[model samples]
Target chain A: MTTASQLTPRRQATRARLLTAAAEVFAERGFHGASVEDICEPAGFTRGAFYSNFASKDELVIELYAEHAASLRQAIAEVAAQPGLTLPDLLERVVDIWTRDPDERRRWYLLTTEFALHAVRDDDARRAWQRLQSQIRKELGALIESIAARHDLELAVPTSDLVRLLTIVLQGGLGQHLLEPRAVRAGALEREFLPLLVEATTR
Target chain B: MTTASQLTPRRQATRARLLTAAAEVFAERGFHGASVEDICEPAGFTRGAFYSNFASKDELVIELYAEHAASLRQAIAEVAAQPGLTLPDLLERVVDIWTRDPDERRRWYLLTTEFALHAVRDDDARRAWQRLQSQIRKELGALIESIAARHDLELAVPTSDLVRLLTIVLQGGLGQHLLEPRAVRAGALEREFLPLLVEATTR
Candidate 1:
């Protein structure tokens, strides 16, 4: 029998392939439209392999959800930790990740838009999404609280509301982006956005 | 032959019935899940009536979209006209319509949430949504700019961004409302939210 470490490279490659394939399938066919077979086909994997790795399509969705959240949090965390970085810098960086690449951002928007409704219908998926959102709120809230302390701002809205506000703006930008991406792409969305947040917090 | 005024009342009644039925069906079954038949059944109308009044499901959706937009603008117009009304008052009123009827808001949220994606997929629906949103932005922006002028406050963001930002927050709040109507009640949500918007408009 092959040891776990011995198969690490292969496992890593398969996982990456599966995720990439899933994202493509999910974007093109929507969450409900895509099947496990469609996702696996792109990855050159069989249903058995998919099942072995993930219990079901919902499970894969949860995993992908977690990955995207983690990636977002990580980017924010890095910016938050960067030396001498102003709030403007952090905000711009955050917006760039989502708005910089149209194709990537569109795919991300599709996933999020579909998954939100999917979670609503599926109890297990809803729980998973709720957990992910809760965690993000916690993480982001802490970051905001830290920033508030540095800036000496007393927010009228709680850090959680602030997180919700920013998240909504970013998500809603996807709707606007779907309509007029060029308009949003031209300006500094979060750059101009953070000051309002800063002002609200101070008030 | 139906005279313009004579047709107006009948049209209004039919429109009301259609909107009410559509809202109910959309709330229950989502945009894609609910069909024109679902909406027509509750309104006591046949496909002929639906088709006569509206070309397709998208047409019906656009009508509902227009109604909501008109209602919102009317609300804002009333509050905006109130002499010496503080910015906070306007914000409160804006938030109130959303939280006015908890049950109704839940239904509205579900319908509106589904509409965004549907708008993106359907051209006619997308144009309808964009038209309404543009009108909302223009009207809301004018109100915001007026308030800023009267208050002698410098908004950190432009009026368009302010309207877009508020719209997004409202959308997210509605999304939350959909998921946990009882938990995230209107009063609890509006508590700090109003101040946040008002303060953002302040210098």
Candidate 2:
């Protein structure tokens, strides 16, 4: 009779190892290029253990997507909640969060560009992706409202449009990193984008 | 003798048929999925004919890229040359050129996302894509300069950054179209993005 409290630390360690291995394998070989054997070997696990933990590669990918979406939400929240921060200041913080974390960026670019396509084509994967993106959209929409209130600004466009642009720029920047990594200076995006963003909101 | 202008009307029709067929196959099935057989089938051409016309799929894709890039240049040139147009009017023209052309948008999105990845992974393809993009950047940069001059606006940032942003948004908007075909409203991009453009360039 295994109890909830009785789950072994070894199990947690193995789960972490599998996730790290998944991220690495997915990054290098891609979702299609990397096989289950490739991922398990990196994590020092056998096929049986891999199956025991994750039903399949698809299942593991879904879990990773959820995890990443949650963390992104947290990052945005951290920036948005900063006391006395202006709209541009908060936007800059969001840019900093994305560009500064290389590991996060790597996993994100891979999942969004490569894996997300597969998800879009597959029904189950597409639903999961929609759910994650919906959560992100909700959080971002709220942040936009908060900023508008704090700044006493009415956006020339809808808030949804603003959030959509931010997401596109963030994803485009990540994809660009995969192609030309050197161009992704940490503070460069905010420097270039914030003034325009402020104008859009204030107008 | 196979003189430069000696091609018969029948030969010209065949060439046009092959090009049209190839475009459809590339858009619907992607570069990999659309084999020589698939393209030739739609055109009622044999493998020998396909080989005679196009040395390889890579060459065919390069030609498509060239055509798309050329059309974009023409669109930008027309927009920039429009006399007595305000900045907002110029931007509206740019957005229309980008989003309203259905066939061009389909081919451009497919090529940029899937075909560009194929190019990035292969040195030969990378060179071909780079050449196309360089041509595009040069034309866009020139058009931007013309617009700035007409408006007497001294940009705070480099014109190169504006071009980069435009390229990223074009690709990103196309990407969004794949998921939600109606996401990119024709005039809305100009409306939302022009304020930012003015701010970046004006003061």
Candidate 3:
């Protein structure tokens, strides 16, 4: 096996390009609609390059989810590390990160729903999907715990319950917004619901 | 055009069978995966019968949404007509109607998500979908208004906003449950969040 240092910068750049291209193709055409050739063409790479980078399209999807989860955790960590950030302020920042662009937001929602349907149909995919979900939940639980400690507030519900509630609100809110943008505006959850949840949980 | 009375009972039964079969087939095979032939085979009908009832698969999907919405309205009306139901009690009953059967729940969720992704790609479908959504929201708003009046309670938010919040919570909650059933159990939203919302909105 080649060591990380042994991989050339050019190969690393090609891998990154392939991943980005895959996200675009999958979002636009869906997993079944999109093909390996479609991803390779836009990335200016060949089938051989894509094959070398990813074992299959499913692997790329798993990687995409992993990357998204990691970035989310990083953003949460950065926000948590800030000094004296109020709960509402932290929530606003997090919501801003998640709901930046309407078009990109729709794309992400479509891709996620597609993956969810896939997970339901395939056992192996469900296992991988659940693993990522569990990781995100754990990280969110930890963040909530730390925030509660800093504010000298006791959560009215379990940390896991609170995290699950937030997850439902965020995912469900995104689906509504995508379906009816005017009615369910972006950041509606953070603006209208998150504050209520925070208030309800705090002693 | 044939008059409604002129249609035989057998004809009416066939149409109903086609609709029910269409729902099951669409949920199991998805919109694109399913065909008129597949729907007819299971319903013990022919492609001709399916065509006589629905213009196409798209039409069947639209009709399915309409039937679901109508049943939901009827349920709400029945619950509202009850003599001594408090807002919390009304909410619990509504939630119960919506969350009664896990298998049926999974099918509805899958069908809704499938239609949502379709709406993203098709403008005509989106328009049809939004019309149904608007109707549902209007009915929900009216229900909230009537409940508030009966309880002598003042809403802290706009009726529309309250409905939207509830929609986000339910839809988002369903998506989370689909992904990780163990973590987000069935009826968790009604059990935990709905009571909090009713309390928040009440005096």
Badly placed stretches (over 4 Å) of model 2 are A1-21, A34-62, A79-92, A119-127, A147-156, A181-190, B1-21, B35-56, B119-124, B181-191
Q: Write the per-residue lDDT of candidate 3 for residues B11-100, one digit (tens) a residue.
A: 777767788888888877987788788888977888877788667677677777777867876887799779988767887888788788
Pairs clashing within candidate 3: A172-B172
Residue-level lDDT tens digits of model 1 in B1-203? 12224557888678678778887888788888998898898779998888877778876776676677667777777877789887677767777766777676665666676677766666767677777677768877887787777778877667787777677677777776555445466555555665766676556
| lDDT, candidate 3, A3-68, per-residue tens | 225668987777668888998898778888999999999778899988897777777787777677
Task: Report, for every candidate in turn, its global Cα lDDT versus the true structure.
Answer: 0.71, 0.69, 0.77
Tell me the DockQ of each model, to 2 decimals.
Answer: 0.46, 0.33, 0.55
- RMSD in order of candidates: 4.3, 5.3, 3.8
List candidate 3 stretches off by more than 4 Å.
A1-14, A41-55, B1-15, B40-56, B80-90
Provide interface RMSD per model, one decimal. Answer: 2.1, 2.9, 2.0
The deviation in Å at residue A173 for candidate 2 is: 2.7
| Sliding window of 10 residues with minimal summed lDDT for model 3 chain A | A1-10
Better of 1 and 2 by DockQ: 1
Among these predictions, the greatest lDDT belongs to 3
Q: What are the per-residue Cα lDDT tens digits for candidate 2 across B1-203? A: 12214567877667568778998887787677789999998678999988876778887777766667777878778877877988777777777777777676766665567766665456776666666666667777887777777888876667766776666766766565555445545445545765575665555
Alpha-carbon DockQ of candidate 2: 0.33
